[model samples]
Target chain A: MSNGIRVAALEDIPEGEGIVIDKSVTGTADDIALLRDTDGSVWALDDTCTHEDASLAEGWVEDGYVECPLHASRFCLKSGEVQNLPATRSTCPHRVEVRDGEVYLFPNETP
Target chain B: MDADISRVVVVGGGIAGVSTVAALRAGGFDGDLTLVDTGEFPYDRPPLSKEYLAGRRDLKQIALRTPQWYDQQDVRLVNLTAVTALRPAEGAVELAGGRLLPADRVVLATGGGAARPPIPGSDGERVHVLREAEDADRLRTVLVPGARLLVVGAGLIGAEVASTAVDLGCEVVLADPVNPPLAAAVGIDLAAWLHGQHAARGIAVVPAGVESFEPTAAGIAARFSSGHEPRVFDAAVLGVGMVPQTALAVAAGLETERGIVVDTCQVTSNPAVLAVGDSARTRRDGLLLPRTEHWEAAQQDAARAAATLLGRPAPPATAPWFWTDRHGRHVEAVGRMAEADQVVIRGSFDDPAFSVFGLRAGLVVAAAAVDDPTAVRAARRMIDRRVRIDPARLEDPSVNLRALLR
Candidate 1:
């Protein structure tokens, strides 16, 4: 859907944590990974690892980088840029907007 | 002299050489820079053993950087050229064509060549070594399904080629002088498991030596020192090790021991010249450190070389780390695993996810993991920081590794 879909409330995702919103709108099963920064900012990206089929939601998030658990490739949550190897390409970034203490995930326009 | 450098010449266009050029530019060195490489482009080498040998990754995919990156960085990439001589006194490098280029500073990143041990019939047409792309291409041609292959030296390259060949439907026999090869690097227990993994994947692991090779009517027959019968194979590959390219440095009168000698800053005896990568023998605190051949070590060496050339502070040294992928599993090891007094293991090795941490006096000295990088990463941090850890807590899988960071 072009319109924003409410995924979770601010309290659902703690500071410096991530959650996988498995909505089918992104053309895959629960592919959107919503990350809440320590600064209380929410960002979204495709959950699938660019290097492998691992989930980014299970990865460790620190210093604005989401490191894949499988191969330890770190991806910048904000820009979806691959910061380390075993992965050469950036993952797809999803559009996210937060308002009224709720996180909304819009369909990735670039996808 | 204010260390005022204008033109910098880097020999060898491998990862170390490319990283040196890139690091120089990224570190804001806009001076005249030239990268002389023997190849058409700087390409990654690890894939040459596995993916490239398996024909899974192409040259374009494995290239370290696009051709445009050199042009954008204004780095004069002199491809298909080799430095014949190093005139360090005059700060000049002589290319193969007898062209002399003046350089305020020189970085030697000439990497290494595959060591071809002298064995009877080792020079045969069917025998090969996987060092360059051309070598991998040639091996790929003979690695068809139903092909029989004998790979010598069960180290990383040999094991990788054996795995790839097995996946390609080739009958593989990997032989080394010692059982469970790479014990010194991966520790004895893990090396045994790794050797077992190869055997489990339909590849034969032999603890013996190839006494000689003879070309038979059907294929190449290899005589083993283990008293086994002469085995025939379609082809053979050598993954023994690397011989550092240090002849040019030696001829140039640079102090060399094992490799081109360099101090902690990666500067040769002559400050105007520097060396990095497999060819650089580093000395720290008046002790000559062993030259590392891993890809990440090369990158780190290049960074230090660039910093030394730029007169900038070298980055804090981190514990040595390396990784290898085999049979669809990723293994990473950090620090010195060989010298640990005790090995604390987390997770069951029988199960797929496990990490073995080498402890010395309650501190993590080294660690190796199979499919579990979280432990390796934490172990690296603990080792680097010299953090005292409770081995009991380390052995307990229930204790979170990150919690130890605090």
Candidate 2:
């Protein structure tokens, strides 16, 4: 099961935005976020804000950055660099691949 | 003197001040450190509002560091001295006794004094604000069994005081302008839960603003803004709020907004000066976080500022955390959440051990746990890692949060 990637359909997420996929892994409690960018590109990152523990999913997505809802700190969707104060560290970004028109997100490993 | 080698003078002998000193020492700073306090001793402040009020702990137990620790750390302690004037550019501070101490660096740790609301005829022997040891001692005497106690403001401090009073078998009436206690900090729903807890424990909570107060034959009469009725009690404890001690910082030509304006590194407007604790307002994303007042934040801010001064990369902001104790139950909250978000409850709220997770935009933002330390600790990791969890899974008490990280 670990070797074969689980494919999530592209239609699962709306165009130009992201949605959290509710998939229960063997050891994880929460699901992962699958993002569909403006360019029809897919990127995956942690959905929670590193600072103050706000939700990144609720944050505003613009200019390839996600703005934290609570404090307005922005994090790059691609590189996950925190582009503002308050949140100094970058968020965890997962590897994404699209196979057979299906989106697959690898669990984030980099801290 | 070299620009890098600066003497920082921190005012206030409380937790914020000493914590800053400890941070500086831990940062490998060999610079001269001077800590001034009006009180003759250095002690923790939180207990002054709770355990100390209940006579469970004394001043010695609350002291953060002993005299020997100060000497070993090479920190100069100036007790019973009040800072009268701050001349920033001049690099000097004038004490009330007319002594001028020079400092290349200055830290305003002079936290704040408890605010006393204007209640006519409420002064004399029965009114007090528990900000100092003396205030707690005076209130302790009035906590005898069957003593009538009226506590104003249902804030964290006031609620704790009322809980202590109730535990001592005192007839306690908690009056507040808000509908329920802790509404300002947590929210109406959480506050209602807290209100129920207090009510079940026999505390009479009055959700009405005060109009006037007068000394009556029955002790004291309190008129409400509603004008519907008047209530009387034996004594009144005010827990309105704290007014930050920014006068010294302002006098020193430091920029002051709601608090002493500081950068991300905790550096004040004056480069040679830094502010921490309740007095410093840290600006992030154009908004000033005017001190979380959680003990951990103070220490972290001090450490970050000291490290920045020593030419190290600024440390990341500490995860916001705070805990409150009431009736043998520990309530802990982590992360920031808005009232508009969806709240998921894990386990039964009626149960002593339960946790509430706040979700927004399909992501977890904040969490509150009551006597659920394992859940609280797990939530802290998610908060630190910014992990998004399934709202349903988080609400399921059967799911262990620690396993979610893997």
Ten-residue segment with the worst summed lDDT in candidate 2 chain B? B181-190
Q: Summarize candidate 1's per-residue lDDT along B318-399 as a digit string, tens digits.
A: 8888877778887888999888999887888799789899988778899988988778888888999999999999989998
> Evaluated with TM-score, which candidate comes out highest?
1
Interface RMSD of each: 3.0, 13.8
User: In model 1, how large is the Cα lDDT of residue A92?
Assistant: 82
DockQ of all models, two decimals each: 0.36, 0.02
lDDT (tens digit, per residue) of candidate 1 on A36-104 = 765678888888887657888767676787888766778998889986555667888877888899887
Q: How do the residues B1-406 of candidate 2 rate in per-residue lDDT, one tens digit apiece?
A: 2356568888887767887788778778888989998987788777777778888878876676767878988999999899998877788788997998998777778877887667776575667788889899999998999999989887778888988999888999888867765554454566678777878888887878777778888688878776547888788888888777899887777889878889888888888888888777889888876567666567667777777667788777645766777766767777775532888888887776887777667666677777664565566667677788888788887875655654
TM-score of each: 0.92, 0.75
Point out the worst 10-residue segment of candidate 1 chain B by lDDT. B1-10
| Native contacts kept, each candidate | 0.20, 0.00
Residue A19, candidate 1: how far off, in angstroms?
A: 5.1
Model 1 iRMS: 3.0
